[model samples]
Target: MTRDKNKKKPPAVQQEKLNPRELNTEENKHSNHPLLDTASAEIKKYLHDLIEEFKDVLLIQVRQDIKKLIKEMTSPAQENTDGRTEEIRKEREASEEEFKHNLEYMKQIQREYQETQNSIEYWQNALTETKDNLLKLEERFRAYERERKSLLKITRNQKEAILKLEDDKKIHNLRIKNVSEEAGTSKNEIQKIFTEILKQNFPRIAKRNDIQIKEAYRTPATYNQNRSTPRHIIIEIPEIHQKNRILKAARERMQVTYNGKSIKITADLSTQTLKSRREWGEIFQVLKEKNMQPKFIYPSKLSLKINEEIRYFQDKEELWEFVATNPTLQRALKDITEKERKRYQDYSYSGREASVNGADHGMRE
Candidate 1:
């Protein structure tokens, strides 16, 4: 079962000619052969062991390969997903190479068939068995493809759901940006600064102490920059109404400043929501350039109000498809389509493998 990569088969054995057509009359001729049944049993055993060995490794490889494929598909950035995508590509290449090697081994069996003429039924069975292995690989590959598509759909939905949940959690949370990123800064200092900003802009609620800060801290992940501080403080309060009140006070005030430095107060959004909003921002600008106005309904709905009726775009594909049909955005959509295709070109699969072995296979690959 072990093959020395550099080792060559014996010339006499390698060149042995085999008449596979003997299979047509094999049952008639081998019916009376004494050794036929024993040889058939041995061949079947060899095939069973070989197939079982390969199947175990193949199933494991397919599991890992499909996981990588799903990860690559779900990632938003093509540049970063290359490593996992390459893992999938290598898996397929390995599968193809193994398939080719197995095919060659099957051919060796065919060539050796003449040696088993006295036991023709056994040789026939060996040929039949080798082909089943090939068909097994083909069948598994098809299953992998089906599973990949199903996982991708499920993952996309899950990502959207996770983002929605995260946004919901932050309903009672607000963020402060462009504040000091100084080390050794305490939460009390941040809380004090925020209270002053709120008390100035929102006297009614600030006087009543309705805007209470349960906890406040500077975000941990920060980059040091000479020109500006990196970290922003996040203030967590108890009630959604208090959070809403703070947001409304900031909006009502034309500008909110702390320690003579301008501070921005905004609703805390999940990374997914921010990314979606960023992408939509560009699309909105594109619409504006076309002399068309698009409405962004809160929580990720893009719509066009035409004749007092709203036409909604649920996702990027729908929005782009609508754009491409519009006379104004057609040119831009063409470029976008080409970019998207190029970005995802690596995800394509041919679903091909080496040819099946044996002269005649009813168990088709």
Candidate 2:
């Protein structure tokens, strides 16, 4: 056994134990090794301070740059806002000026329209007044025309009346001349006889006569020469009657005798013989000269023959007196004269028509 034990004896364990100073010294030595200790101290103290200083400088720089950027952006925006406001003001002023010009133009047009209306009114009134004046003038003209027509009618009637009076006077004078010549006496003697006859038949006409009578006698030789034949004595008679009476006396005395007829105191007759027949023609000639024919005195030819038969008795004083006293004969004579005057007047107005009708219906016809 012992032999085996020798082979296994472990080496004696040596345990070293040091003082505190010695242990501290060894620890320091290990920690103070050049690379290890110096490197650690430098990193903690110097490097950490440098990094803090750099971070502060970077923060100050960033703040300054941001302030400058803010000032630059705000200045430009403010200027643009001011410029936009001024532009809007100018546009408003221009619009106001345009509106004022339009208002003035409208007023001018209104004034012109009013003046034109006044002119139209004035012309219309003038036309109305002119029309009224024309109507008044037309009425006056009509009144004047009516008065002129009335005056013309009055003048025509007066003219006809005057013409009728003149004709009666002329006929009366002619009858007086015929009576004086046939009576074979002075005009005064014929006037006296007519006056006496007028006194008996128409006393009014006889009283107005201013006449005288003278005797008339035939020569002895003249009486003896015609003694074998019936004595032809003409007696003077005055024309004292009106025109109508004288015409009637002449008409009553008118005769166509086969033989000699006796002479009435109022009218003369031809001799009582065949040669005396020629005297009847002379009586008709006298009637024609006086513008009185048998047709004019009588309405029909038959009445004219009857009148001639009644006149055969030439010595009928009553018949002669009746003719001398008639009044209508004068009216017939006057009508003839008026017709002649009107014929001439009508010839001037209506030409030939007036003349022809006047002649056909006149007293002379």
What is the lDDT of every predicted structure here?
Answer: 0.67, 0.44
The lDDT of model 1 is 0.67
Clashes of each: 0, 10
Q: State the lDDT of candidate 2 residue by residue for 1-365, as single tens digits.
A: 34334333333334346466975685576756565455456656555665575566668787778777877887788788778777877877787787788788888888888888898888888888888888876765454444433443454445434543543333223212112233445445544545555555445545766433332332222435434443332333344344345446445646312113322332222123212234234333443455444232111011112323423222112222333564433333333445544543554345234433443345245
Q: Identify the leading candidate in terms of lDDT.
A: 1
Candidate 2, after superposition: displacement of residue 4 in Å?
82
Off by over 4 Å in 2: 1-102, 163-365
Residue pairs clashing in model 2 are 183-234, 183-235, 183-236, 190-236, 190-237, 190-238, 191-238, 244-329, 244-330, 260-272
- TM-scores of the candidates are 0.43, 0.25
Clashing pairs in model 1, backbone N/Cα/C closer than 3 A? none
Runs in model 1 deviating more than 4 A are 1-155, 182-184, 204-208, 221-228, 248-254, 286-299, 311-314, 324-365
lDDT tens digits, residues 1-365, model 1?
34334334322322224366764366577676555566566667767766776786789899999999987787766655697689889999999999999999998888787567747887778889989987987786566545554554465578668877888877667888877665224778878878787776677877897667887877764555654555777888888887877777787886888767788998888877777777666667666664556865544667764445567875565565475567545654443446544433333322111111211131353
